[model samples]
Target: MNAEPRPQESLSGKEISPTDPARFPRLGFLLGLVVVYWALYFVVGAIDKPYFYGFIYGLASALLFAICFFTWWWGNRAIRRSEKILGFVLIVGVGVLVGKFSDRTVNFFPLCTLGLPLVATLVLGWLALVKRSLISSHWLGFAAAVALGFGVFDLIRMDGFDSSLKTHLSWRWTPTAEQRFLAENAASAAAVKPSVAKTVPLHADASTWTAFRGPNRDGVAHGTNVPTDWNSNPPQQLWKRAVGPAWSSVIVIGDRVYTQEQRGPVESVVCYDAATGQQVWAHDDETRFDEAVSGAGPRATPTFAEGRIYAFGGTGILNCLDAETGKVVWSRDTKNDSQGKPPMWGLASSPLVTDKNVIVYGGGEANKSLLAYHQDTGNLAWTAPAGQQSYSSPEIVTIAGVRQCLMFHDFGLTSVDPATGRKLWESGAVMKGAPRTGQPHLVDGNKLAVAVLDGPGVSLVSVTKEGDQWKVAPVWASKDLKPEFPDFVVHDGSAYGFDSSIFCCLNLATGKRSWKDGRFGRGQVILLADQGLLLVVSESGEAILQAADAQARKELGRFQALNGKTWNSPVVANGRLYLRNAEEMACYDLTPRRQASIR
Candidate 1:
């Protein structure tokens, strides 16, 4: 009939055939579906609801796997069923093994969650191409191509990608500059002479930051003339020093700067000269707390009051130390008193010093959820029942003429009398089991602006007293601005802070967004009320100064303040700007006159 079939013209060549023309259109449709599904998945995942984010991403990844498997089946029909099944099993099994044990810097969970299916598709395509010699294996190749393409696309779209992505991409990579600085500083800290307490005088009245988030636990910087224009005259870098891993902000009292950090395996409460950045004195305890995302070190900023520093460690250790000497006056293990384990993030609540007691969130579901210890001696003053734990620090605010400490617990917000630890008013329905990390901003005398990691963005709550009972109810809830960790400040009848790392402002009365702009990552902000400016320390390590106008965002000036992740809040004491993270600490002179002594 036809010429005798050549050895080269075998059944494999004719039967296998090129990727069918009819199948090409279907393949294109499936590829488009994969792209569209993931695009919407990413958009939904970034909406700030943790549970919804988990669900959408999980569903999207699963669907992607199914679609890829379908392509494999359509393309590898020539391969034996056993061979195809065996290849799939072998590829997925090896992928799971390697993905689980791989260096986590690249994000271990995501690699496995997104990589296993990709490897399966790739290996299946390889088998069809090289082993079975199926011409239609090109369809499987398309599936593998889609997997590889989206894996990178997803990584780039992650939150905090610009600043934190490098930390994830590199394998066992180290910041050589930061490491050298820490090493040198550690050597210097060790060789430093004894503290000359009598030589340096302490000015108690000169304290600028006596507690966390400034005086009143509000993110307001008073009497500060923050430079509006940094173009011609930039802020001076007065002092730069290396610090250990910690998210604790520096509290400046008198001539010393107090903060807690992890010094290797020890949790250290340190004091440095505010003006010179010299290590004054440091006290170390044999304790350490570690986490993957938050990293190692203390979370709560040290509280300075009554010539003593009340320091709380991430491991639940509370110490009352001498402000000048860094010597432990008294210490208490809060976890023991509460009979509860440390929180997932750690005991991040800073010690709240009142006129009579030092209040801290113990998070113990028993009667010891909120514990108040005597300020001077670490003796138990009072213990009260709070629902569960909260990472937010306790704050003393006067609501409806009643001075109570507000504790945003895991269950909801609870206000208790500081002296007796008596629950004055509790708002359990304000937020559910979602984490309440943001501080409740007092909108006025009776209303509070509260935000959480889940639910509606922010809610305005009104506290009013009808006879002996105090009732707290939501006035309005808006899905405009949701804060993750950084606190927002209310100014000119509006609240300003990061709405999932995007700087935004919301009208307090209506709970509606006035305007949302700027992408500052999940960094902290300080309200320069005196100057009508918003000083934002971006998570990308830049200090940006913007106007507090609700009409529109106007970025006046910006400067690179740090080189790494900066979640630590910026402190403006007198005219100096102090900023630090887990790795380093820096001080900048914000006022026109440079080198003003931080005395």
Candidate 2:
């Protein structure tokens, strides 16, 4: 003690004590690293694909930064080492546990989202409270911080955030809101007025939109009659109804609209009266596939062809149901018969119905991934090899004037003869981590446009046959317009889609971006080729109608369609526009006379 007192005045009049420590140096370094790390990560979103995992990682870094700051701020004080270590361990361990248990329907990840801010509140509060004892103040600060954090999260997500978390923790507890509201009100709507049962107007005698994208599995709604303006004469709200959580799009056939949803533990194949928004029928299966990011329910749209609905659940159950009443005609579980397991995100491929068979892709590599069942019977028609399945639905397109089934799997693009299941051609393009969820867009006769999450870019390929041998060669690749789940449509030699979160257009011939604007999250688009209108259903639930022009982007009109992150594709049948998300669904009458009647 005497020696220390002598050194206190010797070192340039600076205090020399074992307990005293400088805070700025260590604190500054840690802050600098946190700033730089976040800056780089922000850049990653702009250049590469913007993902949900990236947001999670950013939150983790924020929590780590808060911990480091707290450690340094209290280093010079009389702090307990055991308490500090225990606090950090609890923060990390609790976050990991929360993530591990969270699911699409029942979400607890909000706790982890608010974790760092809560930690900051505790640390700052402890530092400010000078009268109390260090140990008591620190513990008190933590309790207060947690309470404040919960309050803040609840305030931000006032629309059923607590209920969602409760449902996740306890499966028996049903989260109530619009989903229940719509279910209860649907009966009233049906009782008030019966559905007219009108036939969907046809253009060029094309098939009804009974599949994922449209009749051809392309995003084009041929010969549609949509109004060009929504300023003075807005769209007439035919009906707005509540729907369960699911990314499946609405497919219209005759007077019914078919989709898939999660009703508690059962995955339901639901059909509603298109005119009245009434629940016509629903067939339930004791299967549920949950993902925290994508939300719960089946991801595949129910396919309707020839008075039958081919419904595929997220858990790999393929059921062929009767169109009139939702009764199971035939059922098969790909997970049971096929050797492959469900992908991390679950089975998302929509069933493709051909003239004689219903085709779907799932597990197994050796001719088992792509399973084709006979249309009339449930017997296996054929099987083809798809390296590792992607979430993308199999599409039937006539490439090189030959009818073949095209599938973009984890490996790359694969084309197989639909009748024989023979591999006609395979592309060298590879996808890593996230699967290809976007369906391939048919450019022209034999050309194709493929967009995956993190591929090299939006790739253009032409399938040609030379002397009975099929070949797939790339025409161009553009990194400027990379789509994750948002599918692009090629109209008049131009491809349009959401480039990450921003909507972009690219020249199909040159593979050069024309312009990118309108940040619409990961939304979906449908082109009314006859009207030259592109109906864009934004992820945040806005309907934007833009001119399908290659020269420049022209947004003509816009309206609020729904209220959530909408990944489901919009459907336009007759003069009615149908839109939905995980929460609700709406029908807007795009008929000119109906639109004029709106006040």
Candidate 3:
């Protein structure tokens, strides 16, 4: 015991130096470092396209690279044991915190933030192996941390990521010039009249349902009497035929019931017999776009004017067809003229036809905002500065005795001179969202009623004139009357429209709710002023006829027509009611004489 005590005292005076390993597996550690670095880079690269994801991924990469390099460089230093432990813990904690924040901030595909923890664990493991004597239990801890971090990230990603990723990835490439040209012509053809050889009128009262509204571009129909009520049991199913997959409403003119449908590889322009609902003629063009919402079909209501039926397809193909026969006369490419891509839901806005020019919202940037084409030929008439494409159709209405084409884009309400496409009055009516699908309604003749779903409720603007200058001011606004699909119709000083899940009636003057209660289901509606009724075709194929009033919301009658969802707004013309679902079209005679006994 005495000899050992003397030896311990001598050892205390001498310096204790831990022997450095002859070979510390430097190549293996470097190889692992390179592997981890490239893996992290690959992950970051995957999410660096969309600007929001790019910033987050960049931050993650910076943190990961810092951790990796610092750990590798200073890991073997003979620092104090407690200090070393604290530094290692701090590095890992910082890495994990950065990764978690990145994951939360950039909520998009593939999860680039997950690579942060993976890189940290790899670096820490490499450092621990290189400097084994300095730290203990680090390898086990790193393994656990990496496994937990990856598991948590994957779980969050699964829940947060929208299913639109698959669709977006498929259409990443920019369309070719030919494709773009085709889209533009398709859009032009959708709104412009085709110069065709004169033929006898199929019906005495052939009128074009040009835009989403009608010939007047308003839901109000004059010159014809439409039945207000119908029989109880299925009424009279005049004609029911299989149509392609489309939600576009049927526009009746003469003997032709013009509409659009999507079959396999083509979004076909189908013309049917107005009386019997029989197929008259059809024109099919290959629209290879495979989309999700509205499916792969034409979304625009064919505008029939001056012997031409103008149709806009899902992929932005505007075609001018002969009203009598489905023949392409002349076409213009809207996609080219506007230098814009199709909206995610496709070019859904129905074409607008003025006296001699066909007006349309291009939804592009620069030289192609709102465009006007010659009705006879597909010649470009005039172009407005490109703004935002809206699913809403353009309207030509007179505000303060001045004829102006009113267009609601993603930015706001724009009034352009229809004759020249010149901007008359631009109001700061920017919607919260980038796209608007509902048509604008003119309330009380002086006020403009516009509805945007999931954004602002409804904005009622007063259109006044100060000499040559026009002024638009917000009179009232309400979030309750958000029109999802069908445009609101103002009648008797009140606005009547369906707001997503419910139908609401609001005072157009004050945006005040008078009465709102109806389980009309999620479907588009068109108001029949003559009948004083709202024809709502629900998503589940049920059509409900309700009184267009705030005080007494009476359901006149309800009937089921198509097998699929009824997205098309019901059309009442020539004592006949036209309704369509995704795959089937039906016509019902609602003449007062036929259903007089039932009522």
Task: Specify the highest-lDDT model's number.
Answer: 1
lDDT of 1 by residue, 1-599 (tens): 67753222111233323443221112334445445545755675455443334545665666676666556554644444544455455455544555455444335445544555545444434433443444533434534544453344233311112222222233233443335656887688579475545344554453377778888778888877766778877788878888888889988876678899887778999998877778878889999887655577889999988789999898889999988777878999999999877777788899899967988887866768888999877899999877577779999888777898988877778888898888888774545445568788887789888885226478888999999999887798888887877888889899999887689999998888999898777789989888788899998789998899989999998899887889888888868889998778888888755545442
The C-alpha TM-scores of every prediction are 0.82, 0.82, 0.66
RMSD (Å) per prediction: 5.4, 5.9, 12.6
Ranking by lDDT: 1, 2, 3
Model 3 stretches astray by more than 4 angstroms: 1-211, 223-234, 431-433, 453-455, 592-599
Off by over 4 Å in 1: 1-85, 92-101, 104-108, 124-167, 173-182, 190-207, 428-432, 595-599
Instruction: Summarize candidate 2's per-residue lDDT along 1-599 as a digit string, tens digits.
Output: 35443222111123345444321122244445445654754565455345544555656765665566566544623334454566556555655554454433324544644445555555445444532332333354554554454434332322322101211222323544435755665566557665445465311235367788887878888757766768866688888878877889988876778899887778899888877777877899998887655557788898877778899899899999888867889998877656777787788889998859888988555558888889888788888877676888889888767898988887777888888788888885555444667888777788888875226568888878998998877888779787776788888889888887788889998989999888777788999998778999887799999998887789998999898667889998867899988788888888766433321
Per-residue lDDT of candidate 3, residues 1-599 (tens digit): 44332211011122233352222224355457657766866774544133224445656665666576557545644343444565466555644554565433233223333444455555456544535443444445544654554444433322122211211112223442224434654664577554433233743253434445577666765544544455534356677766666668888775568888876667788887776655667888887444433344667788877778888776777788887888899777688877777876677767777868887766766647687888888898998863567777778788788888877777777788888988888775565336676766776677777775224578777889998777788786787676655566777788877765577788776778888787555566667776577777776678777788878688888878666555677776766777875567788776545542320
Tell me the TM-score of model 2: 0.82
Tell me how far the alpha carbon of residue 592 in candidate 3 is from the true structure, in angstroms, after superposition. Answer: 7.7
* Superposed model 2: Cα runs more than 4 Å off: 1-49, 52-117, 131-207, 364-367, 594-599
lDDT of 1: 0.73
The candidate with the higher TM-score, 1 or 3, is 1
Q: Note the Cα lDDT for every prediction shown.
A: 0.73, 0.71, 0.64
- Model 1 pairs whose backbones collide: none
**Model 2 residue 30 lDDT?**
42
